[model samples]
Target: MTSVSQRPAPTPRQLTRTSDRLSFIYLERCTVHREANAITAQDAEGTTHIPSATIGTLLLGPGTRVTHQAMSVLGETGAAVCWVGEHGVRYYASGRALSRSSALMEAQARQWANPRQRLAVARDMYRMRFPDEDPTSLTRQELLGREGRRVKDCYRAQAARTGVPWRGRRYSPGDFTAGDTVNQSITAAAQCMYGIAHAVVTSLACSPALGFVHSGHELSFVLDIADLYKTEIGIPLAFDIAAESDEDPGPRTRRALRDRINEISLLNRCVDDIKRLLIPEATARAAAETDRDVVTLQTDGGHHIASGINYDDHENATW
Candidate 1:
């Protein structure tokens, strides 16, 4: 009988490297085609080329299609491509290479349901990122001051002009009634925030479900992040756009909302603050290993796990 010497587990540094290698390819307005078993893409610049095999997730907007050749190429590349249409609809196709990651994702799905754990994780994240700030302190008064009040007033006046319900207070997910104009506006805003948060999470190589503060439910972190904006940015902006015209918001409204959100410096700052807090803790958890086992655990954030991981290096790297 041959005895096996155990291999050393991967360090935290290795896990971070894996995460950095992950990339998200978002096709906001591009065309994909396949012909005779070759895949090609045409972008706004009129440039045509084949996508890199390294691309992990390929997201397409409405009306995007996969041709026979393109499908073959994608199949060979073993990437997961997602097509998103109007009203939050989605379709996806995955290749064989994604099987391993997909399995790891399933393992992750099992650990997301405890709210207390999520809050603890959120506190840890806050402590890690904002060591100087007190978690119990609500800075709404100091932060909002007079300027925040003005923005709120502006939002209310705009809402009134559109004949929409002016709640005269901050909006919450539970506030919207079903099938009303206000409800539609709320849903749209929430959806936009969801998309933005998803994009941000993908960009940061973090898992959206296994989140701090929001817990293990699907879309929890998204809900948390969206909550941060729905009242501050989304509500005001939605009202403003509606006030501009009595017409229903179509593509123009979508474009306007996107542009307005993009222009808000404060919104970007808030997201940056949240990201800085969340990523390190998740990374540290990812690098931990048990005993001598060199098990590779897949996290929602797409991090790999090894044994006895030290978070010091990962923390240092972020700084």
Candidate 2:
């Protein structure tokens, strides 16, 4: 006689709400503390509790101090940590990806390893920026040259639209004061893009080192993905902010970019674009599996997390 059996349902963890999944938290001069499931920032004024579940990435800006306990909690929450500088934001470190599977990363590596596939991916990216045109036959150098020309034109157009002075894009990594307000604004906008790109890439369990367009850097893929949206959003955003009065453009630019990001629902768009670019077939399968709710949930000390990198929103996603 055959017997029928049913598996027990997975228990949901009692994690805190993220309050609409606010993506970025920029802090300075405030000490970070973790109590229970909440993260807080303390200063002379008072204490501000940051909801860890909704925090995508925490920026440790200048003059901020963080304790080991706080770091431990953030790791558990699966939040990405970035150490920042003036012009550009370099990724200092991060916790483990919410997804436990490396299938997406492996697929990325496979495509990146093949020269033809790499070029094809590059063409796909170019097409993303220039959807009306075809770039399938273009060589890598030709593609790069065309992209550069498009960016120059984009800068000029945005400058004209926003009434900002065009003094060319000049930026020295170490020299923060190297350019005008426009330059500063552009730098701030680009930094935000890079951070978002890093978050999405890591969240998908992909390696930022295996880049199709850029190479030989830790954030090569970050640069590649971030550059894809430069014309569509970043350039116009910087130009608009630069058009504002010339006082303190850095914070203003980042805040405005954040607003635009929210307005256009950019996070979900990013996840979709990354899936479309990396592994379409596998992504489709994952989406199907997720729809069927066949995911494997893992519990680390009774804290539940989704088991694989996601195409759609993860069921037990950490953050």
Estimate TM-scores for all models. Answer: 0.47, 0.83
The C-alpha stretches of model 1 lying farther than 4 A from their native spots are 1-31, 34-62, 67-82, 89-117, 120-163, 166-178, 213-216, 265-271, 279-319
Q: How well is each residue in 128-196 modelled by candidate 1, as lDDT tens digits?
A: 433555544333243234335544665666666676666544334433333344434545555556665
Mind giving the per-residue lDDT tens digits that candidate 2 earns over 35-92? 6667889999999998677777778877788987788767666677778864344446
Estimate candidate 1's alpha-carbon lDDT, on a 0 to 1 scale: 0.47
Weakest ten-residue segment in model 2 by summed lDDT: 3-12
Error of model 2, residue 90, in angstroms: 4.6
- For all candidates, what are the clash counts? 7, 1
What are the RMSD figures for all models against the true structure? 12.0, 10.0
RMSD of 2: 10.0
Q: Residue 314's C-alpha lDDT in candidate 1?
A: 62
